[model samples]
Target: MGESGAGPGTVRPGGRTARVRAAVLQAAGDLLAERGFDGLDLAEVARRAEVGRTTVYRRWGNPSALAADLLSDMADQSLPRTETGSLDGDLLANARLVQRTLADPRQGRLFCALIAAAECDERTAGALHRFYRTRIAEWAPCVEQAEERGEVPPGTDHAEVVRAVSAPLYYRFLVSGDPVDVPAADRAARAAAAAARAGAFTR
Candidate 1:
């Protein structure tokens, strides 16, 4: 909904364009994490990225657009889902990945800022939703594989199972202010795996 109708940061540029995008997105992320959405100045971003101010304006136009594009870039750069043989193992792997990310100081702050931005900006919210959807889609296959192996009942909602694994971690990260640690991740994975096996996510 911001900038181009095709979606922010959807273009796959090459050569200098690719490098410019990489730099601009990096600068945007740093600014968002540091000064937040309210302070994300396109001119500052251009300066930090060493790109022309006109280019940043022409490409992104506004702070929300820049934030959306950064999110899109992050989604594109996220690691592929892990393939453990069992649902339990896969969920644990997924939980650990999320835990590690949220527990990281820089990444944690970056996410907090992005989530805060989403609360007030529709463009950022759409990008945030797309980011989660992409990540969920990446991990949902684990639940499908588990269904094939009879680890869970048939007709399980794969996306919900994957979402269940990350929900608790995010709750702690964004709300409860509890420690986002390995043990918390382990608990989340076990709980989600149990719930899925109990047919709680049946379609």
Candidate 2:
């Protein structure tokens, strides 16, 4: 059976079309969390969302597109970067955000499911790459600011520095199966900041 409150009888206090889209996306996220990408069925999503199956089919066409759309929405809704006036502080903020997200039950599972889907679907992979690109871009300015302040050498690769801040956390989250905690987040931030200072990311 479909989830309660997502079914047709629920009233949403918004434009009908917007409500329908939100309901559909919410249903899709729930199913993705519950069953992974292989289990994402548009018909089921539509039924759960109280939206017509035909609308789902006509709009998304396939599960990959649906998953891609979800990723796009997630990227759009993600928090903006923190400006802490120091490389270490800003990078720590970034790492902590990544750690918190990976440590979240629903969000962790959703990310794992999306990554698995990307492995088997080119379009999904592209969407996933774009999502990361957007996130990295959002935080890259912190490193650029660090460079301007002479905390890091001139010509440091700002994006790489941003990527470094999250790499270890993601490695633990996606590869090592280790705990992602505040200490780990701090370590990742410190390591990235140290590397940037040492000119490891110089262009």
Candidate 3:
């Protein structure tokens, strides 16, 4: 299998290789969601994926590497940002998207597992950071557009603005354990928009 030029854990192969990768990642995600990182066993994952243990061990080597690959796959599959023609509208869209994902049963548990795994594993932590960076870059253009429209200061940090919109939602998801509903999402979006307009994210 030829490795993708993008980065680690981003191999893009065809035919049997691709099928094996897909099955492995799917099994890994299920296991992570079910038992977090501690319960992620390469042999069990191989069984769940219905693939050879040798194949799983040779391809990923360890649970952390498998987690990294799963995160890479997630980054590759994440949805594109919504363009709504206004800063508030765009930010609202972003906030709602985050809220929905973090509020979903399976997805929410999966993310919690990933975050917990990242806390203890350096490789998983790096992969998690890279995943968020990729997501932030994907949505940062909305803030840049707002700046171009004179909605915010010229030096406003676009990525920071985008992060602000998600910070509160994530806080609820990972810390406060509050429900991430529509109201919370809307509040986060408005707060971020207000902060941006107030030059709070200025570089």
Candidate 4:
């Protein structure tokens, strides 16, 4: 929540231990963006965070695990699902959030780096998948709300629907290398919205 260059002093106390953990997690994210999965050094991370290296190793065990935790933390901090009184609007909002996240100067490259690293690392891949699941779960209710409003079929897969809105953006990032611009986001949202209406995402 603090600026990128903010000191470790911004850490607050829900409890002393919790504050230290939070500082370590935030620092991990910054470091991951600055360096990368392969570039990550646990000792260096601990030193920069002003936390103990032993504690870091004991807690997360390794760089990949630390990346997972950092990503999971980011999902928790993501904006709540937008309910704009219309299914199309809600889906578009979700798409736009994805677009914005992938377009961030540092976070964008950070994600690309993580995804590439996960390709050969099963543990990292599973952890990254779980992170996506968390984000999808957070937004699933919007789809459910749509079903209740008769905007989507009753059997529509809410999680899948939310995931659909993001699939194209990731495809572009990972495969297509196409622009994740506003127009692309809008198209992804509209496509997902239409598909859901027609039961494409329904089980």
Candidate 4 lDDT over 36-77, as tens digits, reads 777778888888889889999999998888877766666555
- Per-residue lDDT over 61-140 for candidate 1, one digit per residue giving the tens place of the 0 to 100 score: 99999898888888877878889899999999999989888887667778889899999999999999998988998889
- The stretch of ten residues in a row with the least summed lDDT in candidate 1 is 1-10
- CA shift at 49, candidate 4, in angstroms? 1.1
lDDT of 3 at 59: 94
Clash pairs detected, candidate 4: none
Please report the candidate that would top lDDT against the real structure. 3
Clash number for each model: 0, 0, 0, 0
Candidate 3 lDDT over 1-203, as tens digits, reads: 00112222233678889889988888888888889899999999999989999999999999999999999888887878889999999999999888888887767788889899899999999999998999899899999999999999999999999999989988988899899899999999999999999999998
Candidate 2 residue spans exceeding 4 A from truth: 1-14
Cα RMSD to the true fold for all candidates: 4.7, 5.3, 4.8, 3.7
TM-score quality measure for candidate 2: 0.91
User: lDDT per residue, candidate 2, 58-152, as tens digits?
Assistant: 98999999988877767766778889999999999899888888777777787888888999999999988988998998899999999899999
What is the lDDT of every predicted structure here? 0.85, 0.84, 0.86, 0.78
Model 1: pairs clashing at backbone N, Cα or C within 3 Å: none
Give the lDDT of residue 88 in candidate 1. Answer: 96
Error of 1 at 154 (Å): 0.5
Candidate 3, run of 10 with poorest lDDT = 1-10
Runs off by more than 4 Å, candidate 4: 1-12
> In model 3, what is the error at residue 147, expressed in angstroms?
0.5
